[model samples]
Target: MANIMAASMYMKIALVCMLVGTLLFVIGFSTVSWMVSSAYNRWEARGVWKVYSCGTSFCTYLSYGAWTYFGRNDYEHVRATQALECIGLIFALVSLLVLLLYLLVDSCRRRNSLIAFVVCVFAAVFFIVVGIAVFAIKLGYSYHVGWSMGFAIVGAIFMFVGGIMGILQLTCR
Candidate 1:
């Protein structure tokens, strides 16, 4: 039992993060989808681009696939899942980037809105930077399995918080 737990630490952490991210994505998507659909139904509302939220919803699920793969701890599985995770990361990151663009475009109408935009930008950048730093250290210390997993857990936690914020904004707004 101890050996099993020891072997699956990374998997356990990854699963926890994935579950949290998935829940946030669902709430965020539902809120945004409802808002946009209602606006369209009203006919008085003009078209608004919301591709970022849409993309995030899709990629967030893919992250689950990656987490499953990573949990398996098979080299081939990890590689495949890592690729998917990276793609999902790209989509997730792009979603945040697009939100920034939307904020920039509409910056004239709202003063305080920029604050949320800035926070989102900061969160996204922090996640990306932490992920890169963790991966870099992992590469350098290839022999240190436990240490690398620790860094990965930190990165995953950052992503989880960032994702939750991304979703919360959709509903709150």
Candidate 2:
């Protein structure tokens, strides 16, 4: 009974971390500040095109000037990065579902939950890492990195920590 309780506690903590990470990832992925540059006036500027934006923000997923800068290549790269971020978000959602099952399903197999959680965590990390790599390769040299990148990195770290906690819970049981 104590073992079960301990595992439950760890799983709960892991779930919290994963959820926080997912939220951070979403914010980071959508923001246009992933890459920043400074003006002569010392003002920081972000890329004009981003994965998500509104008219109020004066940014879009693709802008007319993007084609002027790199033609179709920039557009394609941004689209691909957006797809990878979406995949990471999907993996996070799946992990949340598995965690919910782990908490609620008394009769569910423990091994299945362990496997599912681990796979989801790793998959999320993989997608996030790839997306960040692409962004870095495509834009890092041209512009300064910004808070969005930091947020994504921190989010990935949180997911990694949650994965480790999940593993510890399984082993302790």
Candidate 3:
């Protein structure tokens, strides 16, 4: 009985961490400021330039002068960046769904829940890492990482920690 209670506590903590991480991921993914081009000149000064994924195929760039540009134009790097971001978002959502299912189904099999949570957490971490890596590599040369990237990184860390906690919970059983 005590073991089950301990597992339950761990599970609850993991769920809360995942929930907050998911929210942060969503916010980061939606924002246009993953990277901002630094200001260089007066007219050539790209003031507060920001880029954001619009879909798997395209992204939007907002210039310093309030001008917005949209188009993939067959840019492979841009497409890849967008795709990765989308994948990360999907993984995070799926993880959240699995955690919620574990919570909702009173008759849920413990073994199944354990496997599902582990897989979901790992998958989420993988995608989030890859996505952020691609984004950083592609833009790091020309732009500075922004708050959105920071949020995504922090979210990834939370998700990873939550996964570890979930795994520990299983062992406690």
State which candidate has the highest TM-score. 2
Full-model lDDT for every candidate: 0.36, 0.71, 0.66
Candidate 1, residue 20: lDDT: 52
* Ranking, TM-score, top scorer first: 2, 3, 1
Best by lDDT: 2
Model 1: colliding residue pairs: none
Question: Alpha-carbon error at 71 in model 3, in Å?
Answer: 14
Instruction: Tell me the TM-score of model 2.
Output: 0.78
Candidate 2 lDDT by residue in tens digits, 21-78: 8888777766667876543323333432443333433544544244334244445556
lDDT of 3 by residue, 1-173 (tens): 12324347777788888988888877776666676653432111111124333444544554323443343332445556667767777777777777766666666646787778778788878877887776667544656777777778788888888888878877887
Write one digit per residue (lDDT tens) for candidate 1, span 60-156: 2222223332256223433443443354445445544443344334442133442443354345435444433443343232222232233334444
Superposition-based RMSD of candidate 1 using all C-alpha atoms, in angstroms:
22.9
Each candidate's number of clashing pairs is 0, 0, 0
- The TM-score measured for candidate 1 stands at 0.32
Better of 1 and 3 by lDDT: 3
Winner of 1 and 3 under TM-score = 3
Q: Each model's TM-score, in the order given?
A: 0.32, 0.78, 0.75
Residue 120 deviation, candidate 1, in Å? 13
